[model samples]
Target: MSTVDLGDVDRFTVAALGPVGQRTFLLQCRSEQTVLTLKVEKQQVAVLAEYLGRLLRDLPRPGHLPEDLEVEEPVEPHWVVGTMGVSYDAELDRIVLIAEELVPEDEEGDAARFTVTREQAAAFAVRATRLVEAGRPPCPLCGGPIDPSGHACPRTNGHRPPTN
Candidate 1:
């Protein structure tokens, strides 16, 4: 399969566009003149943040987190991610993120890989966590999103819908 290797990124971030519960999540990386953007799911962003945070906990503390973690526009995505993998490169003290494009099982999918400094990774995790949390609040009973109108919580057994 083809691959886009962004050896080291000047900036890397996850961003959500549009309103909460109706947002489009994106993963972006920029290295010099090259910029790569891929579409990702909301759950993917949440899990990535959690995994990155866990990974960083075992490594040396970041000296300084990146100041800017915004996703650069035009916001076009190269492909939608079907699967992703992340790992820490201890020797280089950097984090590697690999995203594979969504494709049919019989087809070969493209891949993008990038490396980020510990500082960038830390900043990314923090920013991503905040972004994911900024969405609609979850129902205490059913663990599903409580809409602006109301939530038909499964635990309610259709007796009453909770209004947020």
Candidate 2:
């Protein structure tokens, strides 16, 4: 297996291309000289954002905080992520992302590991929260997403369709 270690990254963010309902989500990390993009599921992005927010909230403040954070879409993805792991690195004061690449049975898989600062983690969490909330509104009755066309609310028993 191969590994892409981007130690002390400059930027990291989750982004989606296209509309919320029909979007392709990505986890992107970059340094001054390198950029790495990985395909990820929307649900994974949402969960990571939520969990990262909670994690950062519980940790002590770092010595330095980023003034601003930016999210940029890469030209192409290096690999699609099959699984991912996130953790805090106290020694480096960074948030680590370990993304395992998806590969065929005969081929060896690669892992992309990167570290972003605490400030970047906070920014990522905020952006992720916004991205998740930007999706279609939830049905009041069934709690399912209310699509632009319509929604079949379980509570209605097929009698009436929920309005967008």
Candidate 3:
């Protein structure tokens, strides 16, 4: 719903991660045990709240937590997103979504930013050239099988782009 659903977060703190020029928030879910992450657009908050209330109203009474809109309780078992299963926590009086945090791990060489040296770049080029020469087909850019072609390109009226 919201970029960061508040349920599992602590103390009203929402973690916002960056792609620099874009406005986005990484919603984090943490228990005493684990943490999960998700990124979403900011405008979805109101819609998320409406759905949460609709989802939680099934509880007999006071299942909704006024102080924290993130937590929830349901009167019966239900499927979230029509798939992931979660239901009300009557004792806790909060609606809880049972899902593993959609967290992604960082791979080597990827970060906020980095500089590539000429020597390293040249070495990469040589290796790439050799790999390509070993027996790969012509670049789909020039000519090759349709599925193997990278683009959803088609000739129009028997007029193709100039071929290699």
Candidate 4:
């Protein structure tokens, strides 16, 4: 088993590539010396963002906050995420993300454990919300996402229903 300890990470964020409904989501963590990108499910990203926001809101304020909130776009991912764990480190005064890599049987999987400041976590939540909301709008008839090419709304039964 391999482990990457991205101690006191400089930046962390979730991003999606390609068009909505056909997008590839990613979790990126960076330090001064290392940049790591991990492939993650879009749903996972959404859940994490919500959880992080709640966690930060509940915890007492940490004295120092990260000054900048910018996420960089990188070309490739180091690994695809299999499982994840999030917790607070009281001693370090940071939120920790433990991301395990997906690997084939007989191969040792890698795990990345990184810590981010409260401010960074909050910013990540905001960015993730925006990224998710920017996707395809919901269909009025069935409440499902409407693709650019239009959606076959179940409520309409493949017919052009009257639009209000």
Candidate 5:
């Protein structure tokens, strides 16, 4: 795809999902302002099968969405889902998701879609951040692990003992 500069974000169509469901495309580019999601269909997903983990970032268009995100301080850790795995009826495509569900000459009708609460989105984002941070070092609070087995932080879920 071609690249274009639009002030803060360098716009580009990273990948296109072909037929079937490759799921190989695994890319999340984040800047101070926004996040750009890139992914492949079932084939590409199969290719990257070995190194796949939890999602690291959720691409959000600053202009679009609820008022809270627009106010933009530091959003609480959220479990933000996206159009990656989800599919819709093209007609009901929102402006935020228009790019993902491109049509030939535009069409009519609504489509199936998935929505998430702010809290849930925040939680997802935090989890993704934790996963990325995991590769760096161990966290004192939880012994640095996302898996339930590493539920070591007493402060978080009261899994450990109280210190003197």
Candidate 6:
């Protein structure tokens, strides 16, 4: 399998497109001349943010996080992400993010590896959390999204209509 090593990324962030109920999440990163975008699920973004937040807590606080954390235009994803992992490099004081492309079990998929500064990591975590929270509100009883059309909450056994 081929792997794209985007060493020392300059920009990294997660973004969502479209409305709350019908949105597409993307994990985008850039290192100098190269830019990579990957399709990701909302749950993945949420979990990644949570994981990074926890990891950052154990490390020293970052100073002067990046502010222009917006998704670059023409968000053409290279591939749909299957699995992702992150780790810290103590010597370099950076965070490494690894993402593998989704593929059938019998086939091999490409992978991407990148490293970002602690400041970039912190910015990404905060921005990703905000992007995930911008989605449709979850149902109180079932914790499922309350779609604008309607949500047949399984908790109530379809007995009541959605309130929001």
- Top-TM-score structure, candidate number: 6
For candidate 5, the per-residue lDDT at 31 reads 40
The 10-residue segment of model 2 with minimum total lDDT is: 62-71
lDDT of 1 at 102: 96
What lDDT tens digits, residue by residue, belong to model 3 across residues 54-143? 553554434222233132222111211211223555565544543332234442211111121222222322332332233223435544
> Tens digits of per-residue lDDT for model 2 on 1-164?
98989888887877877876888878888878788888888778888898888888888764455545454656477888888899988777778889998888788898988888778888788787888888888898888888888888889987788888
Candidates sorted by TM-score, descending order?
6, 1, 2, 4, 3, 5
Taken over the whole model, the C-alpha lDDT of each candidate is 0.90, 0.81, 0.32, 0.83, 0.31, 0.92
Backbone collision tally, model 3 = 5
Worst lDDT window (10 residues) for model 1?
65-74
Local distance difference test, candidate 4: 0.83
In model 3, the runs with Cα more than 4 Å from the true position are: 1-21, 43-45, 60-86, 89-94, 99-164
lDDT of 4 by residue, 43-152 (tens): 78888999998898898864555545454756399889988999998888889899988888778899999999888888788888888788777787787778777777
Q: In terms of lDDT, which candidate is stronger, 4 or 6? A: 6
| TM, every model | 0.94, 0.83, 0.30, 0.80, 0.20, 0.96
TM-score winner between candidates 2 and 3? 2
Off by over 4 Å in 1: none
lDDT of 5: 0.31
Scanning candidate 5 in windows of ten residues, the lowest lDDT window is 4-13
Off by over 4 Å in 4: 61-73, 104-107, 138-144, 153-164
Q: Point out the worst 10-residue segment of candidate 3 by lDDT.
A: 107-116
lDDT tens readout by residue for model 1, 1-164? 89989998999988999988799999999999888989999889999999999999999899988888778876999899999999889898889999999999999999999999989888889999999999998888888998989988899996688877
True lDDT of residue 103, candidate 1: 98
Residue pairs in candidate 6 whose N, alpha carbon or C atoms collide under 3 angstroms: none
